[model samples]
Target: MISSEDHARLSQAIREAEDLTTGEIVVVVSEQASSYRSFPVLWALLAALVVPWPLIAITTLGPARIFLIQLLVALFLSIFLSFPSRRHALVPRFIKRARARETARREFLGRGLTRTRERTGVLIYVALAEHHAEIMADTGIADRVGPEVWRGIVDELTDRIREGRLTDGLVAAVRRTGAILAEHAPPRFDDVDELPNKVFVL
Candidate 1:
């Protein structure tokens, strides 16, 4: 959902952030963490079950007709809920957060953040559709910084995303993360850039 210009801005932010500390920062923005496909199906099934009851009680329709109507309702509602917006609505907030958090962890590992020379890698992940964000730090940095500090960064990024300023939020987050790492994990004279300074939009 970010434009090329915004991508450039994020890349610049990453580069600048990494300039301050030895920590390698990776930014990933995803359309969604999980498809949540089953939520729509479950909703459709529930609707169909409740709908047939009303038809059976109010109308003298035959069992065959009521069954057909139930099938039709289920089919229609399932298709309707398949839309991204509708499907997202059918999922609970906790489920969304859990999926997003899991996705962030997977991305952290998949991106080789753990393999950095000093184990000082950080992943700032944002899932737009889920309205969630997470900051994951590798062992080196995690040993020095607390989870509450990262939680504050995630909270700010989420608020900016809610305000429709995704790029701005990321830039701010990167800068803040850099400041923290500068304090806890200052760059070494022989430090080298070990990760790409680009935003991965999935």
Candidate 2:
């Protein structure tokens, strides 16, 4: 969902940030982590089950009529929400964030962020649909930086995302993260760049 220019901004942020630290920083943006294809169907079924109750209590409808109405409503809702455009709303926020976290974890490993010689790799992962972000520091960095620090960065980035300025948010967070790394994981003279700076669209 990010433009090339925006992506470049993130890459630049990474490069600038990493220049002062041995830590490797990677940024990843994803529309969402999981398909959640079953949510629409489940919600439709739950809604249908609820529909018959109101009808039975308020409409004086016969059992057969209620059943028919319930079935039709369920079918219509399921069909309508099955479209990708509308499906995401059916999934809950907590589930989306959880999946995004899981996705980020996988990406951290997949991108070799966890493989940094000093274990100072840091991953910045964003899920557009979930409006969620995570900052994962590898062992060496995590041992130095507390979870509260990363939580603050994630919170700030999420606020920017809600305001539709994801680029700005990322840049700010990247700089902040870079500063943190510069303090705790300052670059070694012999350090070699181990990761790409460009943001990967997942």
Candidate 3:
């Protein structure tokens, strides 16, 4: 978690270096944790559905026939059970509509902020936490600038928050960064102007 003193100092640096009035700075306090969870029960259930394949084979004409039947059964079962399991198991409890309303009230009272989900290719998230907040961008940024620069950018943003002028600091950082990028990056043209006499009669 970033101390208020640090936030103020960073904010001041950004304000002095860049000319900004309104924006936000994101400070990641720790490494991002993996979001995937292992569901033993779900895996076991799926395995159980395949266990009868041998019995089907011995009672049938050939292995291929038995395998095809088992495949169909598995597909059917997967489709049938996936939806309810997702609603009950996959989604976070606090994210359900009714629960979200209650959670939002508590969050507003405590932090004066709310959570929001952003979609870019896949769903990314931006949420206020106990001591800090997160800013999520698409994976493409890493591809474009590489991880080191990307991390540096995030760190710079976090540093700017220390100045006690988050809004102005961020705005200036964004504008100046954009200018630097524009200067160093290659030019892009949408359409070329055609010469009037260059048309050919075919």
lDDT of each: 0.93, 0.91, 0.35
Candidate 3 TM-score, true structure as reference = 0.27
Clash pairs for candidate 1:
none
Q: Indicate the residue-level lDDT of 136 in model 3.
A: 32
The C-alpha local distance difference test score for the whole of candidate 1 amounts to: 0.93
For 1-202, candidate 1 gives per-residue lDDT tens digits of: 9999999999999999888899999999999999998988899999999887888788899989999999999999999999989999889999999999999999999998999998999999999888888999999999999999999998998888889899999999999999998888888999999999999999
Index of the highest-TM-score prediction: 1
Which whole-number lDDT from 0 to 100 does residue 156 have in model 3?
57
**Candidate 2 per-residue lDDT over residues 76-191, each given as its tens digit:** 99999998768988787788878998999999999998889999999999988777789999999999989999999999999999998989998999999999999999989998
Tens digits of per-residue lDDT for model 3, 1-202 = 3455555654454333222211122222221122212333454357656757666756755767666666766655555545543424543444443343343334333331122111111111112221122223233222344445434544555555555444443444444443333333322343221111110111
Error of 3 at 150 (Å): 2.6
Model 3's alpha-carbon lDDT is: 0.35
Residue 48, candidate 1: C-alpha displacement in angstroms: 1.3
The order of the candidates by lDDT, greatest first, is 1, 2, 3
Ranking by TM-score: 1, 2, 3
In candidate 2, position 61 carries an lDDT of: 82
Q: What would you estimate as the lDDT of candidate 2? A: 0.91
Native-to-model Cα distance after best TM-score fit, residue 33 in candidate 3, in Å: 16
User: Which residues of candidate 1, in runs, are more than 4 Å off?
Assistant: none
